[model samples]
Target: MTDTERLRRWRLVLGGDDDGTGATLTGDDARMDAALYKLYGSRPGGRGGRRGAGLGDSAPSVARWLGDVRTYFPTPVVRVMQRDAIERLDLTRLLLEPEMLDAVEPDVHLVGTLLSLHRLLPDRARESARAVVARVVADLERRLAQRTRSALGGALDRTARTPRPRRPAEIDWGATIRANLRHYLPEHNTVIPERLVAYGRRQQAIKRDVILAVDQSGSMAASLVYASVFGAVLASLRSLRTSLVVFDTSVVDLTPDLHDPVELLFGARLGGGTDINRAVAYCASLVDRPDDTILVLVSDLYEGGVRDELLQRIARLTASGVTVIALLALSDEGTPAYDTENAAALAALGVPAFACTPDRFPDLMAAAIEHRDLTPFTNHNT
Candidate 1:
């Protein structure tokens, strides 16, 4: 906008009073800068000259810093700074304490950190931690459950549709009338139906199978968190037989815990070596019908086990009519770090590989069910 405005923005980004922008900050701006400086320290120049910043070893200091950051910044910015404090400042161990857990903001990333440290968490803080995790899960489900069900349910019904009806109850009247609209007899002012389209009653019958093969390595924490919640939502739908298989060199079927995402998250043991081939083969064994199954592999494609066998298994899966999609990530954090070579290998075998956001996942599943080209979703994110 203006030179003054530009310099002022640069001052914030650079961090520190004498940041060489020739701009001065005071009052709220000054306090906001101090809160940032406490977490990020002073960058003085630009990138490399970063000085360390810490809120000290005590809970009071971290709590006060959290309050100041919340007062100065919005929710999203505050969450990011909190995560940076945990990672950059080594404040993760402090999170295991009850006071520290209560004084922080709750979000998806925080849940990932919590779940990763579940085994080491102090007993006193376990309840508080569960509350925080449950709150975020409930909020996500409230926003996502309806949309996921609507999209997948509609697609399932569409896929199950038949061209001929065996009885009057099975006839899709709307589709039938539209199909014969041009054959209307003007004398009788009505159309004679020659063909029938079934409305796909479904009832309690399983329409399709969906298997989520998730990687639970340390770097894939956030992806697994979102995937678990989505798996719970998908398992809730009656017309689909959904199974969730999580792996980190070994596989664990947490589908039983999918009824409660919070428990499912706790059941996941994060931060381990990855074995993509082993996991895929295990999930493959679970598949009963390849043509009617949608297998989503959520990982960054960093293979720690037989990479060649993984590619071969993927080729076989795609050849047998399984709709295979590779999600490098499933979070709001754009531009995830992934193995480009492995991604390219999967692409060569007719698999659509890319990171997908939670908001876009429902539509992605619907498109997979319809066997529609998923390039638009891939292109939009990639």
Candidate 2:
């Protein structure tokens, strides 16, 4: 790009007049600058440090700032600014205002903030708050639900597929073609089948049991929001007996509300000291068939309860043939702060401890079900 263009971009980045770019913003750019200044003006370590900040306590002013940000920024950038506004300005009261909620761009972080404030929400603002949350949930389910179902369904079908079909009706033709694709004879226009993929003679009643144990600490807000949505999706799969358990210092079984993630999210009490052992013990008690169960512990492994007991319980779970994995995080935040010692011990016990993105989660679950190598999803390549 030209030097003039570069200076203009840098001028926007460093909002100060004496930022050394000698670039001046006008019209729309000026309005954008004003919107950003209100939020970040007094934030430390910026181009101009700690001058003035916040849009003030007026409802219209906050709502106007929200609208200005949306107009000036893309949806992703708008969401980030909204998140920052809440954190930097302590704008929990903005969420309680219907106009502020209506003007705001809803995202996962926003949903998480709303869920955290679910208890204190006023009766008048609750519907609008829920509508914002529901919109985000619908969007996530639209993007993720089909992919999750498809991946898990394929994995489960493969798990139950037989190599030899007794009759033509029992053969899975599409699967057979896929299995023999590499052995196809182009000259004959046919596949040379080395082994056939077929449907099992009898289907198992319950294919697998999935238990999602989530940590609901204040820092784990985003993870809980994503987990709640996934819990609902997992619950919808009839063959998998899915259970949703949320914990802080105490454990609350939200399996009954798993059908509606919004309700399940409302059930969560977010900010407290973590007790991984107590939560794990409660979830383990619900596991009737260990051999057929996949227990996913979504936590940072900060043990407030007995550490040795938690590790021992996990070891016993893995020993009894239950698949156990500890997700240090399950959000776009990448690797969060977790107890390295606990993670290392869990890894030593043949369980994978890693952070997974929401998009990669379905594949992660599929691999766990089919017993596939999980290294790709872990992103631990050094």
What are the models' TM-scores?
Answer: 0.90, 0.92
Q: What TM-score should be assigned to candidate 1?
A: 0.90
Q: Write the per-residue lDDT of candidate 1 for residues 1-382, one digit (tens) a residue.
A: 9999899889888874467898998999889878877777733543335665568898778988999999999999999899989987788999888888888999998998998899999899899899989999999999999999999888887777788767788887888889989889999999998877776764678877899999999888888988988999999988888899999989999989989999999999998899999999988898888988999999998999999999999999989989999999988888899999999999889898999999999999999988899999989989
| lDDT value for model 2 | 0.87
Give me the displacement of residue 33 in model 2, in angstroms: 1.3
TM-score of 2: 0.92
Candidate 1 lowest-lDDT run of ten: 42-51
Per-model C-alpha lDDT, please?
0.88, 0.87
lDDT string, candidate 2, 1-382, tens digits? 9999898888888886578999888999888888888988866776467566778886677889989998989999998888888888888877888888888898988888888887888898899989998999899899889999999887887777888788888788887888899999999999988888886635656788999999999888889989998989988877789999999999999999998898888888988899999999998898899888999999999999999999899999999988998999989885689899998999999889998888889989999888777767655511
